[model samples]
Target: MNDTAYTELVMVREFKVSPEKLFDAWIDPVMMRKWLMSMEATNKSASSDPRVGGLWEIIDVRGGKEYRAVGRYLEIDRPIKLVFTFQMPQFSEFEDTITVNIKATEEGCKMVFTQHIRVPVEENWTDEDTRRAVEEFHDSSQHGWHYMFVGLKMLAEEGITPVMPPASE
Candidate 1:
């Protein structure tokens, strides 16, 4: 039986804000923390530099377990496109790349995020495992982005930044 794995998950969302604002929220650490840390079970800390070749790291803690993701920016086109690599410390050998594209439209901004996973042939990869992992990742990614956009739209419209939950809370 062949045991090679490859898959891509794509999610698109429309935000009721300008592309510039949406892009800023994504790349800015302060704004990112607001939405990225919304989950009740998780604590997130991130450091990001938005230029090409810049570095980023996100640490998530849940149930006394920690997961760290490190990545480097590959391309940055302000308010339009961003490409970066994503890898988990525990799964360092498995590196994935994600591309985000934002476009201005008549109503708002259309944001598309695509994650590409490349699994080595030696992992004895199975279709069931791949599908489950991809589905879970895609769902979580979409939820986080949607939450962030909600906060962004609130800020853009009300001119008030939403309060983020306290880390210990």
Candidate 2:
């Protein structure tokens, strides 16, 4: 009966690091730039305000094209959970919500990452069209998150943070 189409993609990752450390990697701008930037990206920058209602932004340059993502923190429970809104303006105007739940474990921590994407329903589109759109978006978003998680796992286990670049004059 809902007019809008929405889907939730859930992913789980366990890391060999404490919950606090893993949680920081999610909000810390410098650490985010290191891992969130795709391997092919040559230049990347990130800025964040790690508080509820705060805003965050990241920009990555690949082949001289900039890909930017912006978000606002909706909920923040340090070392435990975080919920935020994520959107890439250049790609789509629709905003998606992402929730990260972290729990301490014997070895380290477990993270349950869930992304909720809501696609607006257009009057002109058929049911089949809406289904395909949701499926395609869900698959691509899952793949992207999987790639980012690989980097996050490496960063968390390594325990060595990457140095920040020198500021331009």
Candidate 3:
């Protein structure tokens, strides 16, 4: 519960679509499934109610395994902002808060996404291995989000659904 255990990841992207369209792509399962999740994820479902306190979940099937993220909405401001709690279904102890802000531009719209996550570091927080693991986790998290956001922009702006990568053999 020390301040040193928290992690914050932020990403911003501009799209050739309005805030409304970009926002809808986030809460509508039909549009979301077209872009969300890794390229290898299949049989995916993104169900959500775009209102405060409503629950949302994303489930994806990969190689006969199901992975899911379930969360509850905290705020919904159409075409502008949304805040929510995000968590993995199997990892009750690990949860994060995500906030997305959208602003309209003469050209299109801009989105700023922020996720604040807390990692549970053991009592000896100064250990080298633990520090390295945390660093690696942050790097991977940043990389993953950047990749996914590109897909989202493509879907929203171009109406192009990127093909899902084939499942591994």
Candidate 4:
């Protein structure tokens, strides 16, 4: 199957901080490395220009495997919106676009994060094993982002850093 498809995933979460504070964490490299990674991963580094047309790269060591996400900022509006393109070098076959919109509330803020990603299915690579692997990768990415969202909320709200293996346990 030469089937090509792009999947969109949306994750919404509320933060106990202002929109500006929550948005800043995503652009500031210092705060980014602290919460933009999966709990199971240790951040190797996060560096970004954080302006329109600027590029960013985040390296994380997950499951003892190095995972790299490189992207460019397409749009930026402080405390409001941010749009970026995401790509994984190892999976150069796929591409992703991410949009983050923040709305300030009486207490804090609500963030609507959307990711539109190309679902990778290489031509002539259709087999039971290959199909399973592709599905697993998609699900893994979904969970990773949701986990990062929780970590971000904690960092912005209670100033608590998410330690590996989850602190609640």
Candidate 2 displacement at residue 127 in angstroms: 1.1
Ten residues in a row with the worst lDDT in model 3?
160-169
Candidate 3 C-alpha lDDT tens digits along 1-169: 3324667888888999989999998898788777666532473788888789998888878788888877889999998999998887565467789999999988999899998876667665667756675776677777867767877877888877767642222
- The sequence of per-residue lDDT tens digits that candidate 2 reaches over residues 22-131 is 99998998778877655323437888999999999889886688989999999999999999999989887889999999999999999999999987677788989899
Any residue pairs clashing in model 4, and if so which?
A: none
Give per-residue CA lDDT, model 4, range 34-127, as digits (tens): 8876542488889999999999888989778988888999999998999998888976655689999999988899999998867656677657
Q: List the residue pairs that clash in candidate 2.
A: none
Full-model lDDT, candidate 4: 0.81
- Give stretches of model 4 more than 4 Å off: 1-3, 39-41, 124-138, 165-169
Candidate 3: what lDDT?
0.78
Model 1's TM-score against the true structure: 0.71
**Poorly placed runs, candidate 2 (over 4 Å):** 1-3, 37-43, 159-169
Off by over 4 Å in 1: 1-4, 37-44, 120-169
- Ranking, TM-score, top scorer first: 2, 3, 4, 1
**Which numbered prediction scores highest in lDDT against the true structure?**
2
Candidate number with greatest TM-score: 2
The digit string of per-residue lDDT tens for model 1 on 99-152 reads 989999898889898888665443665667767766666666556556655655
| Window of ten residues with lowest summed lDDT in model 1 | 160-169
Better of 1 and 4 by TM-score: 4
Count clashing pairs, candidate 2.
0
